[model samples]
Every structure is written in C-alpha cells, then in structure tokens.
Target: MDHDNILETNGLNHWFGAGEVRKQALFDINLTLKRGSFTVLMGPSGSGKTTVLTLVGCLRAVQEGSVTLLDRQLNGATEAELVALRRRLGFIFQAHNLHESLTATQNVMMGLQVHRGVSDAKAQTAARHALDLVGLSDRVSYLPANLSGGQKQRVAVARALVGNPALVLADEPTAALDKDSAAEVVDLLKRMGAERGTTTLLVTHDNRILDRADCILTLEDGRIVRVDDRH
Candidate 1:
C-alpha cells in the first residue's frame, strides 16, 4: 500500500487453458517497482517474462496470488474496473502497431482519446508535443509507411507517452531496430521516466537496455532467478 511503489506482486502465479489441459506459466513471483524507476524483465523464450508484464498491465487476469498495480488489487477487479485501469497504462509492443491510414499526429492522438474530456484541439496539441519530445516534430504529418523503422518506433513511444500514464509496459520495443536506433529509443524512455516520473517495466532480450535499467530481473522456468540492482 505504499505510495512509492508503482507495482507490486506477491506470490503471483499464472495458468493457461483449463481442465486437463491446464498448464502453469508462472510460479510464485514477488516483484516491486518504485515510482519513476526503469526496470527490465529478461529471460529466454517461454520463460514467463511476458506473463508477468501482462498481469501488471491489466492485459490478463491474475489466476492466483496478489498483484497490486497503481495501488489497486487486480485479483478480483471487475471488467469495468479493469477497463479504467487499462486507460491509465501505456503499452508498446515489438511491432509498432500504428494505423496505416493515420498520420503520425493522428496516431498519437489515438492515445489521448481513451481519456475522457479531451477535445480534438487539445489532443492535437498534446500529440504534437509528444511527437516533438520523441524528436519527430517534422514527421508529424508523415504516414507510418513513409517513416523508417526507427521513426516508426519513436512514434510508438510518443503515442505511449502522450497519455501521461503512471506506468509504461514495453515488450521488445527495440527488437526490430538497428543498434543505433535501438539505443535512441531506450535512452528516450529513460529520459522520459526521469522527467515525468513514469515508471517503466520493459520485457526485452536486448542486452543494450540492461545498462540503462535501474533494475534487471531474470526469469527462468517461471521463477525469478537473478536480480541485478543498478540503483
């Protein structure tokens, strides 16, 4: 219940399917992420790294154990409550899932549309500012097809951050970019966390991100086996 912790999980467990086919994907997981901190979840394939992120991000239900996200218990939260909680979270995936028909600004505006009471003018202004923050002021009118891979990812970052969510969940954000572009995206996230106090929990296999993380947790066989604290 501490105000300083953005996310906390105690004895968290997850299972997929049901009946005889039910299979456990996560064991008891205990994790705490402080506000404004940048953390990375790293592990091999099928290691339950994505499971943990989805649980905290409200993308999936917590089967067993407790998960407190943004100070609310997700164990038995209603669907409406989950929808509201999801509005307060920003998610970035390996693929920059921007609408092909929408321009960069229009795509970023989609992020602000989830929050109630945001006028079109306000959304446009915020989108411009967000794109500017990501160093894409000139590309606001550009479509996703016209942009490079890195530019597309930056637009995704801008969209995720435009809402000013309390937490950001990123999964392999830099996977498709080149080395330099990948570094730029990671650095931008770290800088944004410091400036806006936006806690970030990223699941990535990129080693380049480890150096920028305040904490690095390694998951193996559904359990946390190592925690490297750089804070």
Candidate 2:
C-alpha cells in the first residue's frame, strides 16, 4: 500500500457462493487513490464499479486480500473500528436515499447524529454549512417531494459532506438528472474537492461528467483495465 494514498487495495478479491457455482465480483484488484484527488471509476453495469465503491465505503466486508483506508487495514478491522472508519468516509448511492419524512436539513443532520456526542446545535450548524456548500441553503426546510431531482441529490451530497469525511464515494450521482443539473452537481463536487481537500471517488456510467474528473479509471469484467490522468 502506498503511504500517501487515501485508499489502497491489494490483491483484493470478492466472490459469492462456493464450488462450481461461485461467482467473482472483483479479482486481484490493486489500486490507490491519492489524497485530495478527484477520481472517476467508469464501467458498464455489473462491471464491479459499485462493488468497489461498497468495499471502500465499508458497506461490504473484504472476502480476500487487503483493503486499507487512510493507512488502516479494513480487512481486519473490528465492527466498532469499521463504524469509526465509515464515519470518515462519505457515500452517495444511486438513489438519493434521503428520508422523505425529513426536511433536507434534518436529512443532512442525520450524518452528524452518528458521531458519539455531537450536540443538536452543532449538528444543525454543520448541516446548514454543508447544504450551503452544495448551494442548497434555501432548500434546507424542503422535503424530498418538494425538491427537484438535482435538489434531492444535492441534499444527499450535503448529508454525506456534513460529517467532514476525509473521503467521498459517489455512485451514479448524476444519472437521474438532466444535463444542466448533472453538470451543476459535478461542478459542486469539483469545487468541494478543491475547497475541502477531500479525496473523492465517483463511480458512474455517465460519460458527460468524465471531463470533470482529474483521473478516470475504466473497469471491465471485474478488473480495472485503464487509467487516464488529465491533471
């Protein structure tokens, strides 16, 4: 693992089932994500893009080899340690996953609630700041139903960023938006990366936003086949 990398995977392999019926989702995956860099992982459906995102987010346990975040080994981390590690990594899924019942501010505040002793006032302050950073300050009180697709996604991003995470993982963030809205979200992400010094890894099939990525990686058949760095 590279000492300067925010994320590193070595001989990583994930499989389902056993014997002849076994299926491999990722195989011999070795990669590193530099600190404060914006990287995109692009691939067709079922190409292990989401699998890699999930593994990095600590949503899935490593079945083989090693995975590390901020130099801490993830494959051997305890449940409590995994929770702590996840708190330092923000994740945005294809679905905005916002609580329909909660307002945008409340939804963003949810992330801070996971911290051991964050006060309500402090959480609200952080949530407000996050929403403002995403250009959603005016929609803080709006529920998901009242917001546009882009707004909902922005709220999700705010929720993710509210924790002040060291790394941000986004899965198909712009897939549900129109071209203008998608570009807006991409710009927001880029600006966030630059302003906060957060390492961002975005997984997407959306070709339109690829140009905004500092580094682009292509995965196929559960393997990373290409990497292009424009910066």
Candidate 3:
C-alpha cells in the first residue's frame, strides 16, 4: 500500500456457492484510494460495483484476497475489530434508510449515538452542523415523509457525515431522484469533498457526475477494468 493511500485491496476475490453453481462477484481486484480524494465507481448492472463498496465498508468479508482500510487489515478480522474499523466509515444507500418516525435532525443524530460518551446535546449539535453542511438546515425538523426525494437523501448524507468518518461510501445515491435533484446531490458531494477533505467512494450509474470525481474506477464481470484520474 502506498503511504498516501487510505484504502488498498489486493487480489480481492469473492465467490458464492460451489461447483457448477458457483458465482463470482469480484475477482483479482487491486485498487488504491488516497486520503481526501473523491472516487467514483461506475459499471453496468451486476458488474460488482456495489460489492466493492460493501467489501470496503466492511459490510461483506473478503473471500479470497485482502483489504486494508485506514492501515488495518480486514481479511479474517474479528467481529469486534471489524466493528471498530467500521466506525471510521459512513455508508449511504439508495433508499436513504432514515427512520420514518424520526425528524431529519434526529435521524442524523442517531449516527453519533453509536459512539460512547457522546452526549445528546453534542450529538444534536453535530447533527445540525452536518445538515447545514449539506444545505439542509431548514429541513432539519421535517420527517422523511415531509421531505422530497433529494431532501431525504441530503438527510442521509448528513447522517453519514455526522460521525466525521474517514471514508464515505455512497451506493447510487441519486437513483431515486429527479434529474435536477440528482445534480443537486452530486454537487453537494463535490462541495463536501473539496471543503472537508473527506475520502468519498460513490457507486453510481449516473455519468453526469463522473467529471466531478477526482478518480474513477470502472468494473466489469467482477474485475477492475479501468481507472481514471480526472484531476
């Protein structure tokens, strides 16, 4: 791994089942993500983009190779160790995944609750700051149902950032939004990366935001076929 890189995966392979029914989702993948860089992963459906994100986020285990995040090895890491590693990662899914019963501010604060010794006042303060960063200060009191698709996603982003994680993993965050909304969300991501120096890895089919990424990796049939540096 390069000294400047925050994530590195070598000979990473993942497979399911056995014999004739075996399925390979990723194979012989090697990649590096530098700290404070915004990277995007794009591929056709079933091309393993989501799998790569999940693996790096410690949501899935590496079946064949090795994964290192923040200088910690992920392969065969114990449950406790993985949990600790995951605390430095934040994930955003296509569904937003906010609690319908909770307001946007409350939802964002929920992320801070995972860490010990964080008081409610501190959590709420952090959540408000995150929402403000994402341009959602006014919507903090709204519930998921009261918000638009993009607003809901911004709240999700707020939740992701509230923890001040070293890495942010987003899975097709614009999938459920309109064109204008999608662009808005992508712009917000760009601003966040530029201003905060947070490492962001977004898995998306949207090509419009490709130019905004500092690095782009394309995957096909479970392998990284190409890497591009836009900066």
Candidate 4:
C-alpha cells in the first residue's frame, strides 16, 4: 500500500442476493485514491458506483479481492476493527439525515460524540466551529424543520466534517438542491478537503459537480470505463 493513497482496491468484486437471485455487482474493480484529493464516482444507477463507495467506506462486508483503507485491510477485518476504522471516517447521505428533534448544533455535535473521551463542552465548541465553516453559525439553534433544504444539507456537511475525518464518503449529497446550492455544497467539500488533506469519494449523478473534482471516475456494468484527471 502506498502511504499517500488513502484507499486502494485490487481486483475487487461484490455480489448480492442469494441462490438463483444472486448477482454480481462489481467486476475486478481496482482503484486508488490519493490523500487530499476530491474524486467523484459517476455512472447510471445499478452501475455499482455505490457498491464501490460502500466497500471503501466499510459500510458493507467485502466479498472478494482486496480493499485497503487507511493502510488497513478491510477484507476480513473484525467487526470491532471495522467499527474503530469507521470512527476515522465521515459520511454524507442524499437525505440530510439530521435528527428532527435536535437543534442544528446538537446534530453536528453527534458527529464528535461518537469518538471516545470528547467532553460535551469540547463537542459543543467544535460543533459551533464546524457550523460556522459551513456558513450556518446563526442557524445552529434552529431545528431541522425550520431550515430550508439547502440549509439542512449544509448542516449535514457541517456534521460530516465536524470530526475532521480522514476520509469522507458522500452519496448524492447535492442531489436535492438547486443549482446554486449544489454548487455551494460541492465547492465547500472541495475546499475543505484541499485545506485539511481529507480524501473525499463522492458518488453522484449530478453533472454540475464534475468540474470541481480533482478526478472523475465512471463505472459501467460494474467496471471502470474511464478515469479523467482534471487536476
């Protein structure tokens, strides 16, 4: 494994379902991601893009081949090991996935509370700073129901980044926003990744975000067809 590469996959493959319904989702997928780089995974639905992201993100059990995340093998890692590894990553989903009952600040604080030994005061301070970075300082006390779709997504971004994770896995994070809001979200991810050397692997179908990526990877029928390096 190259230390500079935050993620590496070699001859990776995955399957779903069982018996006659069993189907292959990934085919000999080999990929490498450099630290601090913002990469987009693009393809039509059922192209295995999300599967690749989940494999690298440790969200699913690796079924075949090799996946080295942060220099640790994920193929047969114990559940405890995987749980420990997950603490080092952050995830942003298509839905904001915020707790409706919690204030924006409280939602962001949940990000840090996952890690052991973080005090409530310290978590509050970090959460406030993260919200500020995402331009949500004033909305920290607002509930999810009170915020706009863009503001909700911004809160999700703040929550994902509050831990200062080594890797961020985002799935269609900007899919629900308007043009300007989508741009803001993508640009924010790019800027924060650049500044903190946080590697980002985002899965999206939004064409608008292509230009912001350091690299763009396209998958087709469970295979990588093209890799465009814009940086």
Q: Give lDDT tens digits, candidate 1, residues 34-94.
A: 9989999999999999989888988898889999988899999998989999999999999
Clashing pairs in 3: none
* True lDDT of residue 204, candidate 3: 95
lDDT of 2 at 192: 76
* Model 3 clashes, total count: 0
| Comparing 1 and 3 on TM-score, the stronger one | 1
- TM-score, structure 2 vs. true: 0.96
User: Looking at candidate 1, what is the lDDT of residue 108?
Assistant: 97
Ranking by lDDT: 1, 4, 2, 3
lDDT for 97 in candidate 2 is 96
Instruction: Output the better candidate (2/3) by lDDT.
Output: 2
Question: What is candidate 4's lDDT per residue for 81-160, written digit by digit as tens?
Answer: 89989999999999999999999999999999779999999999999999999999999899999999999999999999
How much lDDT does each candidate structure score? 0.94, 0.89, 0.88, 0.93
Once model 1 is optimally superposed onto the true structure by TM-score, how far is the C-alpha of residue 86 displaced, in angstroms? 0.8
lDDT of each residue in 1-231, candidate 3, tens digit only:
676788999999998789999998898988888878888998999999988988899988777888989999999988898899888888888999999999999999988876889999999999999999888989889999999888999899889889988889999998889988888887776777677767889999988778778889999899889989887
Global Cα RMSD, each model: 0.8, 1.3, 1.3, 0.9
Q: In candidate 4, which residue ranges exceed 4 Å CA deviation?
A: none
lDDT of each residue in 1-231, candidate 2, tens digit only: 666689988899999789999999898888888887889999889999989998888888888988989888989788888888988988887799999999999999998877878999999999999999989889989999999998999898899889988899999999999998899888887887788878899999999998899999999999989989888
The per-prediction tally of clashing pairs is: 0, 0, 0, 0
Give stretches of model 2 more than 4 Å off.
1-3
Model 4, TM vs. native: 0.98
